[model samples]
Target: MKNVKKPIAEELDLFEKKFAENVRSRNPMLDRIMRFIIRRKGKQMRPMFVFLAAKISGTVTEATYRASSLIELLHTATLVHDDVVDDANLRRNFFSINALWKNKVAVLVGDYLLSKGLLLSLDNDDFRILKIVSTAVKEMSEGELLQMEKTRKLDIKEEVYFEIIRSKTASLLASACAAGAWSATGDEEKTRLFHSFGEKIGISFQIKDDLFDYGHDNIGKPTGIDIKEKKMTLPLIYTLQQADDSTKRRIIYIVKNHNKDKQKVNEVIELVKQSGGIAYAREKMLAYQQEAMALLHQFPESEARTAMEELVQYVTERRY
Candidate 1:
């Protein structure tokens, strides 16, 4: 953590200006949702990865910026669609697109981002970029479907859960790195390494976020939002696996009941603690973090390498 690279706040301003240019030609309605979400524009980690990766390869160029923006737009689209599916109201402490614009608009917003991503990919006529982006979209959607299929189902298995994370969350991260690598160097081997690295970082990212679900401290969003929504994330899944038959029964009952009662929440919290779910997920997260860093080592050393490693460390240690 000592080696953490301070984020350039100005980079986001660049992203916003570029994004405004990218979306200005679109219809007014699509433009509105795009602008609405972009205004908050949290940490641009995905695009940062694209930019940093390109920079490391000594290929920082227009393609890097365009690819980075495309990744951000694609990411925002996913968030808009996810809000509609999850019925979320609050995100980044603002009303979600679905909450403000309603469900239909949210869906269209996601579609426009997808279309915009495609158009951006064509800027270099790199079919390889298209393939990477399309595959990630498919994997992400399939992950969502899988998650929905198992929602509130107490018998969810670990293998199935890993598959869901890999598809839904990891895939886009992988695409972000892979597309960045392709957009710059077109080296499939190095691209594959970065792709794997991003996926590992992504899975670790989700595991940490899921661990925050039961966090008492202000890790990020409300600790029990997933629990309130009847979602069973990593800690809970690990708890279910390790808890004794009786504790297991109680866990299933509380989750199946979709309990928001203070006592029920505490019960799940205690079970997660006793079952070592938090520790286990932390271990898994660290393992993935190691894997991600190892992947970056293949490229020798550079400023981009430092930033990339710093990004992984940031993801591992972030409170939110």
Candidate 2:
């Protein structure tokens, strides 16, 4: 992340300022929550994508700052909402908004942040950015609902799994890149290209994240948490496809019936490992990473492009 931040330090600093200002409110509780979020924020990867994509397309502008803020605002809202939905008590090692403030207040804060994002676009007349982000939001909702529906049956087809991931994980990234390009040049074709670039890397990014569920990397959550939650990740999906009937039934039984039993969860993890699910997922993740790099190669060599490539590598290579 430090290396990725090097090239865009000045612009990123400005973006941070703008993001802070954009979220400021007079309400004391909301202000405290916003400050807490700022303090515990994860790597500002989405804003980095916005700036890097903007630099690749053209010069950065006020619009670029707003674009980055918009992404962060909406992303933060989702995280807040997700913590409520997951009944999670911690985020980035800090007490989650819901845990500290309770679900009712947390839910309202999330809604307020979402509304801020929408009004930001409207006030600026950034219709293109609005449209792109709105579509992403819609897709994300659909993806979450689809995943919830499939979780009960444990029957996520590969295609459906891909669709779910692309929507839930990739859509915001796609919009970020497209909004960045539009902010820079308003070139429709270039915006579309960057959007596609973001989508490829976003899919790769999500697959890499999915792979983490199979490993014991101390990544906030414990290993096999996904199984406990009955969340069907790509590796599990791929493994089940090649599994024998007996093997499949056993794995499903553990997931559906014994998820709370840690011993059973460990058994399921070993079965997935022996079945080569992790290897298959890694191959697919790398393929998408390479595909995204191919898109970056379409642009001429520049510091922004170089930084973007580094970001892509970081996405795959990150252990947490």
Candidate 3:
């Protein structure tokens, strides 16, 4: 299963070369920025999953390449716009496109990526895939709006937070898998099942990411940015829900009213840990991952299924 890594990279490289044909000529500036991003890519997880699924299911083809690359394009677009919306200065420990290139250029490039994704999906002559991807874009937007609507509000519950992550993160992941399965055979049921698996794993991934916000030297980004941004996440929500009145008030005041401090952030995490909030989140994440794994029951035991299982586990163990 892990052996999929090398083979997947080979395919991505070939596909990317074809995908970038004329990218330099027609859109020179955009191409340069995009090329830079392509050079620094961490993982084409969405595309890799689709390719592996196709391989396991039998025969990777143009359909798999089309669907998977569309996802990569959309994910990159989302990251570009997210940096602008969050006013983030850095990403992957580098200056954000929005910060360095200016938001206007960033916005246009993000829009370009989105347009490219749709145009490429349409080129496949599959209206169904286009519809699914379009719906995913809408889902991501609505989820982000919902999260923003809840920001700085200390009373946000765990259920609501889960709902938010599902919409914002899981929906796109599910859509990617669904598109991949559909590309393979258009077996609607199988597509739906992969979608289910992706949705579960995606939500778990985001929840784990939230957990990293309270820890030191967490992954690529700085810790406690959520607190500085005044956004309440699952762990903090859980702590406030279960903590004593004094501790609850103190946590709220430190995060919401006073300036953001690392010491207070640590104390807040301690409160969440002591109140079993961390344990509860860990359980929830595992349950979601298990649900994701269970969805593979419909498929046979094969290398691809094993690859998919490993993908879910990777998200579960993410440090950031």
Q: Can you write out model 1's per-residue Cα lDDT over 1-320, one digit (the tens) per residue? A: 32322342345457668887786545777677767877877766788777667666557566666777778878888888888877999889999988888898789878888788788778767677778878998999899888888984656788898899999999988888887887789788878888898999999999888878777245643467677767778888888888789988887788778477867877787778777888888999999999888878878787668878888988878887
- Candidate 3: where is the Cα deviation over 4 Å? 1-9, 22-25, 216-222
RMSD per candidate (Å) reads 2.7, 1.7, 2.6
**Per-residue lDDT value at 169 in model 2:** 95
Give candidate 2's error at residue 96 in angstroms: 1.1
Compose the digit string of candidate 3's lDDT tens values, residues 1-320.
Answer: 25656546677677677556513336678878887777667666787777766665556677778787788888888998999987998888878888879999999988888888788877768777788777888888898888888874666777888888988989888888888788887778877788888889888988787777766224553367677767777777888888789988898898886636777766666776688766777788889988888887678888677767777888878664
lDDT of 1 at 226: 76
Task: Judge candidate 2 at residue 286 and give its lDDT.
Answer: 91
Worst 10 residues of 3 by lDDT: 214-223
- Top model number, TM-score: 2
Worst 10 residues of 1 by lDDT: 1-10
TM-score, predicted candidate 1 vs. hidden true structure: 0.90
lDDT of 1 at 45: 75
Per-prediction TM-score to the true structure, in the order listed? 0.90, 0.97, 0.91
In candidate 2, where is summed lDDT lowest over 10 consecutive residues? 213-222
